[model samples]
Target chain A: MTAAADAPPTAALPKVRVDYLPMLLVPLLMLVALPLVGSVSTWVTLTVAALAMGMMIFLMASGLTLVFGLMDVLNFGHGVFISFGAYVSLIALGPLAGWVESDNLLLNIGVLLACILVAMLVTGGLGYAFERIVIRPVYGQHLKQILITMGGMIVAEQMIHVIWGASPIPLRLPEGLRGAIVIGDAAMEKYRVIAVVLGLTVFGIMHLVLNRTKIGLLIRAGVENAEMVEALGYRIRRLFVGVFVAGSALAGLGGVLWAFYRQTLTAGMGMEVNVLIFIVIIIGGLGSVGGCFIGALLVALVANYTGFLAPKLALGSSILLMVVILLWRPQGLYPVAKR
Target chain B: MLPNNPIHSLLSGDYPRSRVLGALLFVVLICLAFAPFLFPGSQPLNVAAKICVFIILVASYDLLLGYTGIVSFAHTMFYGIGGYGVAIAMYNFSPSWTALGVGVIVALVLAILLALLIGLFSLRVRAIFFAMITLAVASAFAILASQLNEITGGEDGRSYRIPEMLRPAFRLFDEPVMGVMINGRILTYYLIFFSALLLFLLALRVVNSPFGRVLQAIRENDFRAEALGYRVVVYRSIANCLSAGMATLAGVLMALWLRYTGPDTTLSFAIMIDILLMVVIGGMGTLYGAVLGAAIFILAQNYLQVLMGQFSGMLESAGIPLLPGLFHADRWLLWLGILFVLSVYFFPVGIVGKLRQMRK
Candidate 1:
């Protein structure tokens, strides 16, 4: 009895068996794709590209899914945050033009870091305002939220045009980040490798924070049963606001990465990728972050492969993938338990 | 009790309910009925014709978004199909009355079938899911239209010759009537007007029917409607199909009027937004709101740019930084977007709803 009492209460908790089935999907898809794609080097190149693209998409979608899960708000204007982030980076990087143009890898990295930090801060603040002004009144009403957020998107996109001018601004990659790094017969872009690393780091941090921290625990609990969490005397509203702001900031960060990848900044860039994001989130299940991650990878991989195999069918491939996945699991790949 | 007259029956007993709204509808009807004679210029007539076409389009959309509580982004896709159907037929075949007939019938069938498929596939899911799916499908359709250059003529789109009776060169009379030339253009305008009126009336009839009541019930509470033994999906799908059919007709009218069909004119997302603005601003759930909203929105779209340009100049002269640019004619959508948000918040019922409420 003394030994049992000495053990922590957590020791008595049942183990949460992680669902490994969904986790195998990424490698499974890659393996299936490898056979279909005959040339090894081209396949490797495509895989790396797909991974980088998937990471960018994951960065954009994770926040949206969490927001939907915790608050039941499908912000149609989520793409605006990405545009805002990218535009903010444009301004932030302007003063550090020397660092951007420099050959030194450390200087280039520093410039990128500073640009990302500023974008996150500005977009985070903007998100707070957006949640307060645009989203607060429409809380608990999904229809109005979708309509109002869409209006917000239209206004924000126009504002971007007004501020940056309508013409597309060319964004040059930093000297150290440009070009490709050869891995055997295959070559991967330097920026893409960095993007993969950054994406993995973000995912790791998110996983750790969500599983280990008290705030993260509260957020997870809130997602499952918001009223129950509130009944337990926790301020779920404040937690939601925090999540909203953080989601916006993450979207902004993703936007910066996406802009660098394209190297062209258009006002509609955010909106153009919006359809893909919607597809990703829907396929991942509306409210699950891990599902969103896998969904993004699946979509990017299918898109890249099909783009190589049959360019005409590339755009339709993702939609087809969504249809197939939905048929398999109507609630999405990893349906949130609440729904 | 109201008189059992044809006009009353035609209106389906769903009157505007407000004296002011009735008067406004009457005025719009009169303006559209005699648009060519009343408006002497080509631009005003063009605006009038556009108003007529959009009234039908917007009203049909109201059936889904307002009455059924379904938001679909693929409405424009069906509209494009109708336009392309007519455009392609007329392009391939000789400019004949049969060509027009064949084109319209084929388009109506295609639009209805596509709508049915979309409804069956997506209406089973949540409204948000349906909206996103429609959006994806619509964008894909637009891309497909553009990519299939030989059929759709790619980005520039296909411009085909209409029948002789509708061409601008064909005159009804040698002499000018009431200072207006009696040409095919005027005939075409009249064709559009009469068809719009008939279609609008048909829509009104449908909405006031028992089926429409079921849709409204479903819109109010789907679960309750289901509990009450109404097949909610069936009603929604039917509403979707009917709305698509009407939108397709409106597209046919537009194609006939323009003599050209392009992705920009028929299927652009901007036009979809415009439709939404008209629905919200005019008043959702009320068909009459579509009439007012479409007319007002189109008028503003045409004339407001000039007003905005002057406002921008005034702001520039005032040395107000950013105000000038914000008020630029090209940025009219920004103002409209703000209005849309405000309207959704403050006037969820919209202009017609407000007017009717005032009367009550």
Candidate 2:
């Protein structure tokens, strides 16, 4: 275990050296799907699109898995943060129509950043209140947590309707972020490329924080045993609150990206994407971040591939993936064995 | 005190004297059955019928969530299956009574099998994992139902003809009674009302039985229950099957009442959440609490919006403009959401449970 902990970020982790066979499923799936797709360019396009979608989902799901893994809270209301972030972004973008219409790349990017920041801040604040009010009392009770959080979600979605009305709001991409770039015979949407970059940056930062920083160490320790962490003189409760806030902020960021990805937002988009998010987290093995990342990618790839191959099966494909994965590894792809 | 044997207690009329709450529910059921005759309106009878269906549905959920300590979100999926079963059978086959009976039987069997499959498969993991899996499966089923447009009617949903006898034109008498027409609607209303009552009682009997006692033991502590020579998984699986079958029956009732079945109405996650709220607000383990919870929830859900509309009108008349929009009938869900959360926190034991506690 000590050796496993001390192992460098890359290569074989001693713990998974024996069971890393399941890790091959992602690549194997991609390889097998390539022939079925039958066009190199289309395959590239599908792969990029899937990766982009997966990254956006990971952004939303990472927080949920963290909160679930660390805090043991099944927040069915996480969708509200996503919806809230998307709606909050609209507040900035709605007025800054001129900036969005602008062709200048740097200025448009600047406007997008500002929207993302606002979304994160607002959602982060909301998460704090949600935790204090709806979540804190039912800390250890999973059923009540599920129920109350779901109730919180329903209210939040309705609140969105109240504020924004029932109409679907348009959130067009900035001029600089619109259209696609040709790479060989394949065309990749410019926004998707940007999303990939942003998603990777988020993942990199999370990986660094969870694995490298002192706070990350404390959090990791706390997830394993909060009492022990407190016994060792760390403020575990404060740490958890911070983690939750961070997760909510991540969901907000994801929401902003997702809104632009679809170029149209509705009140129910958050709830709609929630199933996909759960499938990702479940496939990723609940609490394991790296597993969640892989799980998200796998889900997106399967969904995209199946959508292109058989549209009717697309809706059930991710679920099928989850079931198969669970059959293979009942605990998930990378079960975090905390308890 | 009543006899521990639920059947004996029920037959002896000792149940009402001993269990005041049970007696109260019995009266409510009677009133609900004769509601159409008393009220003489379609709207009131419709609401009463809805309450009855929800009562059975919520009670079935209690069998799993409260008794077996399993929180399965697939309850609504079974409910949808039952509705779609009947709707499709009537759509393709005859709209005759035999077809309806066949549809109900097929739905019940399918629901039980699916429940067993989901329960056994997911129970291989932990409790929380099972919950998540059910959520995934239920949502998948909803999506599939919508996408399978030909048979399920897609978003428009399928509406089927009922047996001739059950149609509204089929009158019972040559003349009206108490200014209320003796027609098929009233007969259908009574049909649902009585079935709901009987199902509620059956649920009560099941929960009070030794099997239910074991389920309660599992809920209180699964590990301890297993330690006391119980196969926890097997018991949970049986409970899951039983609950799913009963929920399917409720779904059959829902389909019959609406004469329609759609993904939105039957299989939606929102309906699942509403069921959870109903169970929680009524009380978890108590069978009678299902009646209280479902009744209160359905009444509030149906009538609260009307009350809110009136209140909004009053506010508008008084020149309280902004508040009126917030209190509009459309925004009733927002208020319901708030109330649900508050209820969960403040009345964790639920209304019936709280009443029971107070009495003690």
Candidate 3:
């Protein structure tokens, strides 16, 4: 505050102060829903389920939001990476089915990690190729970018059919990861708990890396003003490519988790998830990860609660949430102040 | 020739050699109108009618994307609305011609209102934001349409009957005319032909009118257009409404043609992608390009699968196991997607724009 007050007139720098107001929407919503839900146990189960779901969504969305914020490119084909990740995880899981069926938690966890590693690597590599072959030509051209990326996604999805066959393949959860633990009359799925943990870990790591590291600073700076970062003699394009690759990897991670959560995978699964991902990103504000985290939670919680309360409105609830959010803050809940 | 005639046709003098291209198109359209008799089959007429419908659809898209420079993913929503409007009206009321007329009017009105609402709500946001908002809106509508099974028939979709006079079995003549049996299908095909042509002309008129130039100006430099005293938001909203209304008209025609309305054909995002591909492949900001793009794309979409099937059959016969499986007809989307990307990369201005550029 003193520095801001004492700052020279010519150097009126915008404060990087954290805004906590939007964060309150999450707790406020939870509190408001407690009475409507009535049963404490049901509310607990729903809340946990929503949190788990929100975490997975946040993991999926964080990458696209970063890419959009920093690179200012809308890659409508982002879903292909998610699909790639989910499909690639299957390859690792196929031979490891024995290990996955094991009663030993260590072996099951090991197989899952290996699958994640392989999925992330494959998707990250594909993301590199996607950028070079599809995205590179249409830089600064949003319309072309959208059309061509969609084309790329269509081709990729078809390729999935060519490889995986045109059928929805079911995936089995690891033996140890099955079933739920009851706490004080509230039942929480074991996998949901795992998901919540993994989601938080991802969020923490992302928040730390984005705020604490040199690359993170550059990314933040780039998001604010790429031209200035370029003028400062840094190769911002390489950083952007790295960001795109990272974003793709995150999407892949989310995909593997999502596949297990649903226990199924299909060629068009990514496209279906694409709609929800965009909704989350929009409600969170296009470029802000914190906003994305909160937005994801709000959307997921609302969806689960609404689904439980009024089954008919389940699908439309998230959309209604977005509309209400946009109505209140057209730019989003945590819109980055500038380009 | 008067070089500066104000009453020139829409494409006239817009590009070098455009008048010749326009004349060629007129001839092609005339030939297409008589295609059923000439070809002596419904297949030719069906394909031509489809092309005509898409020409109008793609042209209306060009108005939004090409002229106004807005990339809306919600065009299919309006298209679906138009389809559902007609389908529901006919399903609930009598399938009389008057009901069809009422359906068209209601669809158009509904489309305009929805477009206005969407435009006013999201138009203030940045370009990408608007796209995202529309995407959200479109997906929501699709789910709503599917979930509202009573009205939409859920995933199975709803089929409605057309007027008896327009049915394929309806006889127009008791005797053959010039060795050709005239039936209701032929009449309906011609109806599609003329309506599509009229709609295309109307689209051309809108794009050629001074109002369209303002849209172009907005596309180029919106702030500058506003500085020059144009109400940018109002014009944009009107463009949205016009584009939506036009799409709705196409939807109605499609419903009448197919006698069906459903989530898959009407509200699916896949259809939205198809429209985007048509507009982009045709050329942005060039009205004539829409016709060319739609014709080529629809032809390819219909025929490419057959071609792939034949190729795959040969490969299988030749004992190429893995390759044959990969080259099935159902995988046509893979090829279409690749072609879409290549078109954007190689022919960014689209076919007409490329020709115009070459002529210049």
Better of 1 and 2 by DockQ: 1
Cα displacement (angstroms), candidate 2, residue A196, comes to 1.1
Please tell me which model should have the higher TM-score, number 1 or number 3. Answer: 1
How far off is each candidate at the interface, as Cα RMSD in Å?
0.8, 1.2, 1.2
Candidate 1 recovers a fraction of native contacts equal to 0.68
Candidate 2 per-residue C-alpha lDDT over A22-68 given as tens digits, one digit per residue, 9 for 90 to 100: 66877988899999999999998998999999999999999999988
Ranking of candidates on DockQ, top first? 1, 3, 2
Off by over 4 Å in 2: A1-23, B1-27, B316-322
- List the lowest-lDDT window of 10 residues for candidate 3 chain B: B7-16
Per-residue alpha-carbon lDDT of candidate 2 for residues B1-360, written as tens digits (9 for 90 to 100) = 446676675533214222567666767777797797777677888888889999999999999887787788898999999999999989989999999999999999988998889988887567777888898899899888988888899988998888877789998998988878878878888788878878877777788778888999988888999999999999999999999999999999888888999988999987998898888878877766788888888888888989999999999999975787789888887887887898888987777777766666
lDDT of 2: 0.87
Put down candidate 3 lDDT per residue, B21-48, tens digits, no spaces: 6665666677677877777876777788
lDDT of 1 by residue, A1-339 (tens): 798798887775778878777779899989988988998999999999999999999999899999999999998899999999998998878899999999899999888888789889988999999999999999987678888998999899999989988889999888999999998899999999999999999999999989899999999999999999999999999999999999999999999999999998888888778889999999999988999999999999999999998999997999899999988899899888878
- For candidate 3, the per-residue lDDT at A315 reads 91
**Colliding pairs, model 1:** none
Please, what are the lDDT tens digits per residue for candidate 1 over residues B94-174?
778898899999999989998998899889888988989988889888888988888999899999999998999999989
Candidate 1 segments exceeding 4 Å error = A1-11, B1-3
Tens-place lDDT per residue, model 3, A114-142, is 87899899998888998898898889987
lDDT (Cα atoms) of all candidates against the true structure: 0.92, 0.87, 0.87
What TM-score goes with each of the models?
Answer: 0.97, 0.94, 0.95
